[model samples]
Target chain A: AQSVTQPDIHITVSEGASLELRCNYSYGATPYLFWYVQSPGQGLQLLLKYFSGDTLVQGIKGFEAEFKRSQSSFNLRKPSVHWSDAAEYFCGGDNQGGKLIFGQGTELSVKP
Target chain B: DVKVTQSSRYLVKRTGEKVFLECVQDMDHENMFWYRQDPGLGLRLIYFSYDVKMKEKGDIPEGYSVSREKKERFSLILESASTNQTSMYLCASSYPDSYQPQHFGDGTRLSIL
Candidate 1:
């Protein structure tokens, strides 16, 4: 079975601090990976995606994620955190077609 | 930019009532999907359509049905809504290629009374 896992249910970081959200995927082979952010009462917004090219993929809102083949991980990172960046983040993987399996999600809280 | 729109942002319906959630995508993508989201569960695929009039069941499709009469439009119907069925419904579209990322709608928060 293909699945995505985000170990942290929630994380708190002070504004200007660096952030990292861990994600692990289980699949038979390499899969398409993605990170999405959702604000309160709003829809999900794509943060970044990794298909096949570079290991490091850049996304919107100054976010990036690195795909590690050996670790089976696609961890999201941001050098500096902003208050507006506080939101629930989801990690997803697709091995076949366009169907995606998503993790439970990690809620990030940035304190000023 | 790709745009996926849902018919409602908030909906309130009674149990045993028929409910319809409409979604439209302007991207002309070949794949469209319906998902239901809940706390701690993230998102679960309900149904998906790869072409007009073609639909496939996702992880959870027991009480739900879908229609894709037109290429750009997909509808998710609840035959008999239940309290446990209340959730945030999301629609998404993407190219048929497996590598392409999906674009999402603002979502519809439906409540069963």
Candidate 2:
């Protein structure tokens, strides 16, 4: 069975500051990793995904993640975060049939 | 763009009432999934359908049942609503062979009283 862990439950960052959300997964083989964001009362939006390729994958809204197989981590990062970026972010690993094992999610609070 | 539609945005049901949550995807994807979202728990899969009339139990499927009557429609059923079952329900659809992202609906927030 595959599982994902996000240690940070909540993170607060000032506007224009760099931010990183940690994510680690336990999977037997090469895993498909994804980052998704959800605003209050809204559905989740895909930030980015890593199937196989470059270690660093860029995503929407100035977000990027690096897949580190050695660390079993795919952490999301942004150089600058805006107030609109305040939302809950989730990291997930894809199992067979595209079933996703999601982390507990990290709620990001961007202060102005 | 893939459009997954959940039938309700908000629902209020009494305990012990039978509840049905409907989902429809327009992309003709081969896989559809039902998940429940709660604060601090993220999203937990309730059930999924790989093909029409084929269902599979997910990580948390004990309190829920699912049906996939058509290729584009998948439904989640609660035989008897309970307070613990009250949560935001989400429906998503994805292709079988493609690594394409799962498209989600706006979600239905069900409250059991």
Clash pairs, candidate 1, are none
Predicted complexes: DockQ each: 0.85, 0.67
lDDT of 1 by residue, A5-50 (tens): 9999999999999999999999999999999999998888899998
Candidate 2, residues B1-113, lDDT tens digits: the string is 78899999999999999999999999989999999999899899999889999999998998789999899999999999999998999999998853578889999999999
Q: In order, what lDDT does every prediction score? A: 0.95, 0.93
Total clashes in model 2, counting residue pairs 3 or more apart in sequence or in different chains: 0
Q: TM for chain B in all models?
A: 0.99, 0.97
lDDT of 2 by residue, A6-105 (tens): 9999999999999999999999987788999999988999999999989999999999999999999999999999999999999988867588889999
lDDT: worst 10-residue window of model 1 chain B: B96-105
Error of 2 at A91 (Å): 0.4
Over the stretch B27-113, how does candidate 1's per-residue lDDT look in tens digits? 899999999999889999999999999999999999999999999999999999999999999999999988898899999999999
Top candidate by lDDT: 1
User: What's each prediction's TM-score?
Assistant: 0.98, 0.98
Each prediction's number of clashing residue pairs? 0, 0
CAPRI accuracy category, model 1: high
